[model samples]
Target chain A: MIRAIRSELLKVRTTSLWWLILIGVVAFTAVAIAFNMLATYVTIHPGTVGPQQGGPDSLLTSVTGLYTSGQYAGTLLAMVFGILIFTNEFFHQTATATFLATPKRTLVIGAKLIVAVIVGVVIALITTVLAVGSGLIFLSTQHADLYLGNAEVLKSIGLNWLAFAIWAVFGLGIGALLRSQILSVILGLVAMLIGQTVVQVVLALLSSYFHVKWLMKIAYYLPSSASSIMTSPHGADGFEWWAGALILLAYGAVAAVIGTVITRQRDIS
Target chain B: MADGQIVVTGLTKQFRKVRAVDNLSFTVQPGRVTGFLGPNGAGKTTTLRMLLGLVTATSGTATIGGRRYVDLPDPLRIVGAGLEASSFHKGRTGRDHLRVLCAAAGLPANRADHALEMVGLTPAAKRKVKGYSLGMKQRLGIAAGMLGDPQVLIFDEPANGLDPEGIRWMRTLLSSFADQGRTVLVSSHLLSEVQLFADDVVIIAAGKLIRQGPVEELTNLDGAARQIRVVTPEPDKLFGALELPRTAVAKDENGGFLVTGVTGPQIGKAALAAGVELHELAPQRADLEKVFLELTSGKAGIR
Candidate 1:
């Protein structure tokens, strides 16, 4: 297992995509920080008026929304990483060499999962730190209460990081199930964007017409619907943070199980 | 298993309605290069893949070292195989690719360098595989196979894209591998190439093993009854002088005597004794190509 992990790490390290992901995450975080700082400056010293009605907290709310977008961007990148991890074998005909080397196919899959999780967690933590640090620095110029020590600010950063990790796992699941970069990316985009919107709209229409409030609750638990639980200022649908985490975990678990089953039984060629 | 022999029994594979390999049974012994000779689409690649456990067999078994390839602990250390058209990750350096496999197989990292040097790819070690020519890619594949110094090595048309010098290099490499008492099974469509490298030849056509035996046994037509052709002034006298049973003397295109059931040397001795000036005396042995064509043509219909 240790050897397998080492091999997996070597694969990840040698690819140019890994460096690209890291650069993208850091660059997006910096852009998010700059945008927030510019907003704070514009609101603090208006050209015509002395000050704005709402302070940097409104800016914080918008920036926090941007953080979710950034998290999704990171997740998209992870999806690409995960797909390449497996599908590259097929493309390069390395599956034969890999299976011949280890012979135990499941161990190879397990090693890849472990590597993906470790990378996902580390990248998420780093992105969170940079995002929060930059946001706080920008907000400090406007004399806003956006200090890192602030309870709300700390909670937001923590939840954002947690959400980022979960999103990464979610990407892994999608990548594994689809097993092709273009297909996985399309499925991921649909699930993250159109799927959630469609589900929410249908559930809203159903609840309003038939008084089926339970349907709305069910929709909230769906993979995309569950995002609100992490990104919402207050937890969505009165569900605790742990409940949302569990829902995401369930989604990832199901995806992984399906992926592993297909991969193990299918012929490598 | 103890001798590093590969035994395959009742091995079968079907791709949809097409039987790519059917009831293929053959044993490749150690200390000999077994040439897997077949025409194009003769299921050579599929059989090799099944032996390495790259493709699952629909029925029967293939074993190396007395265990299924997947069941073997440290398979790469036990068996090394190179498939044609195998592509390494284009983005990675050749050395890195071998290093990753070495790590997986629990072989020392230095084995990567050794394998590169062995295949004469040491100079191109740092280059990405994308830049490699077809012949260079083949060398890299062979390097990967030799990384673990395994007991059993399989190469599928290893000399496909090589030049004359490269082909000679490959022949030397395979001969050395077999000389080390390792089981070497190499597949090729060219009979002349295998004729030089292989000690034993296994011929297949339409997914069935037509013949497998020592190269000498497959090529020698001694069992077909010796035949001799002679050109002498006295054809009847030459035929009568060679008083062998079941001897047939027939007219030749050049007005020489065509003789059978008598060795060429015996005919020459008979001519010397009979005072018949011989114009032609030659031994006829069936070539490997003729034997291969006859066997595969016969098997093609039954399959």
Candidate 2:
């Protein structure tokens, strides 16, 4: 098992995917931190910018948002990393060599799951650092407290890391189930970016038109929504931090089980 | 030689509507190179994949050392197999590719370099596989197969893109592997090449076994019909002497007669009686390519 884990980690390290993903982390988090800093800057000192968008009321909330600015992007990239872990084996036709080296398919997939979580955590860390670094400098320029030592600010960043980790595992499950690199990445991105948001919009519209408040509640159960609840400073309205974490983890658990079972019985050819 | 023997019993694999392998059974002895010969889509690759446990068998068993591949403890150490020629990452260097396998199998990292050196790929070890030519890729595949230095070796179409020297090198390598009391089974369409090194052959056509035996036994199978070459000064006289058998005599390009179903001494006596002086008269042993063609009933895909 240790050998498998080492091999999986090596597999990721040997590919160019890690650095490419880092570039994405920079692109996404840089934009997000820049946007969050501008909003916070305007909120703290009104009349300095264009019409107010009404940013977070408190400095802690503003800094927390700044720290977790790119949680969604981090999680999305983590999922992509997770999907690639499994898909690359088939896409590159290396499944034969991989399975041949370790005949126990479940062990290989399990090792990959561990690597996926590690990768997710790593991506989250980088994004957090980027956001925090950019946010701190921007805050200093605007004559606001850095707030890096605040516990609430720290907790939000911690959850941001946790969100990346969980989403990565969730991505692995999807990759294992799909097995095709292109399809898994595409579908995973679609579900994260458009599918869940589309469902939430439809549910919200239906609830408002029918005056049924219960209809909008279904949207909170979605993976992205659960992720939102866990990564925020104050948990989302629908679920607590732990509940959100559990719900997101449950999706990963189901995917891992189904994926492992399919992979175990699958013929490598 | 004793423990490395492979016994495939009634192995059958059906892929939906297509029956890829049909009750195919063959055993490979450790001390001999066994050639698994077949035509295109003749289930050669499918059978090798089944033996390696890469593909599930619908029925029957393929066991090495009395255990299925999946059940084998430390399979890579026991069985070094290269079932796919191009099962590698394009971005990874050849050394890294073998090292990955070495890591997975718990072998030393140096073994990757050793395997690459064995296949004459030491210089290109640092190059990514995408930069490799077809023959280079084939060598990489063989290098990967030898990574474990196992007791059993299996390769499918291993000589697909090798040059003549490369083919010769592989032939010698496989032959030597078997000679070292290791079981070696190679599936290929190169009949003449297999004829050179294979001790035994398991021939299949359309997913069914057509023949299986020692190379000598399969080639010398009913050797009577293959004529003895007769280059004589009096070709008409010798041809007429063997005319009693009707189809016994065939005209040759050398202005001679090829006599069948008759001993060399009998042909000499017939020539003596006809007063035909012969310059050359030698028995021609049937080549494997011809025998293979006949056994598969001309459906042989011997490349």
Candidate 3:
């Protein structure tokens, strides 16, 4: 297992895509921090409705949200990172050599999953540093409340990191489910970017028209929706962060199992 | 079979309608080079894939050293299988590519450089594979195969894209591996090249074994069927003397008789008894290329 992980990491490092994605992460994280900071400042007007007491979308919640501004992009990128790591084996045709070295196919996929986690960890760490650094600079300049060392604020930051890690695993699962490089990537991006929103809106509309309130609640379980529970400081649909994490992880686990079983039973030729 | 020998028993791979490999059974012994010959789509690649555990066989079992390839705890160390020359990450350098294999196999990192040197690719070891020509990639694949210095080596078309010079190098490399008492199984369409280096040949056509024997025996080098160019003052007498089962006498350019089914000694004695004076007697053998063509002709069945 250790050797597999090391080998998997080496495979990623040799490719130029890893660093290219890192650059995208850097720029996107910076932009996310700047924009989220501006929104926090605008949403909480100075000398009027300044920093609400402590509920969903309150001043404290908004301020903590600024600290994890990169969560949206971080999660998405981590997911793509996961997708590529697994799909690249087939894309670049390295799976043969990989299996030849370690004939246990599942072990190699397991190693790839571990590599995906590392990618998420790195992305989470980078975004956290950038968002926190920028937020600290903004708060100090205005002499506003920093909300530093607050438990909720700390939890939000940790969850931001956790969200990225989990999303990466989720991405890996999607890649395994759809092994084709172009197909899985396109499907993943579409599902994460538009499919969730479209489905949620349609479900809400149908719920209202049919007077079925339960239909709208189903949106809360969507992978993208559940992920927001971890990164978004505001309590969404009254679901806890841990519940969101579990729901999101469930989707990934199912897909990964299906992918592994199919690969194990199918002929590579 | 015995230790370190590859055994494929009643192996059959059916791909929907077409039987890619049909009840194939053959044993590849250790310490000798066994050439796996077949026409296109003759299941050579599929058999190799199944043996390495890349492709799941529809039926039968392929085992090395008395265990399945996947069952081996350290398979790479026990058997180094060479992939297709084109199966490489184009973005990575040859050295990096080998290092990844080493990392996966738990081999030393420096072994990558050693392998590159062994294949004479050290100069371009740092270059990305995207820039490599087909022959260079072929060498790199061989280098990867030699990484473990395993007791068994399996290569599919190891000389597929190599030039004559490169083919000679590969022949030498394979010879040395077998010389070290390692089992080597190579599948190639180059029958003449295989005849030069391979000790034994496993010929398959239409997904079935056509022949399996030593190169010399398959070519009839020791049999009466071996072609012998005969030059005599009386061609009719010599031709009549060589009339035997499985023997044929054909008129040569200078009225000499090319005889089969009768040894040179038998022809000599018969010629002397028949008062046929021989001007020239020489062995003109039919090489493996001829035998392969004859055996595989019309057997591939458009597959």
Top-DockQ structure, candidate number: 2
Provide the lDDT at B7 for model 3: 93
Instruction: Assess the local accuracy of residue B7 in candidate 2 as a C-alpha lDDT between 0 and 100.
Output: 92
Per-residue alpha-carbon lDDT of candidate 1 for residues A159-255, written as tens digits (9 for 90 to 100): 7666666666666667667777678767777877798889888898999999878888888788765755765557766887667878887887788
Candidate with more favorable, higher DockQ: 1 or 2: 2
Candidate 3 regions off by >4 Å?
A44-57, B221-281
Report residue A63 deviation for candidate 1 (angstroms).
6.4
Winner by lDDT between candidate 2 and candidate 1: 2
Model 3, span A1-269: residue lDDT tens: 99999999999899898888888898988887788777666655554455534433466767787888878877898999999988888888888898899888898889988898889999999888888898989977866678887888998988888888888899898888888989988999899899999999999899999999989989989899888875655557787778888889999899888988877776765
| lDDT, model 1, position B177 | 87
* DockQ, candidate no. 2: 0.76
**TM-score for each prediction?**
0.86, 0.94, 0.91
Per-residue CA lDDT of candidate 2, range B243-296, in tens? 756677778887767777887888888888988888988988878887777777
Which candidate comes out best when scored by TM-score? 2
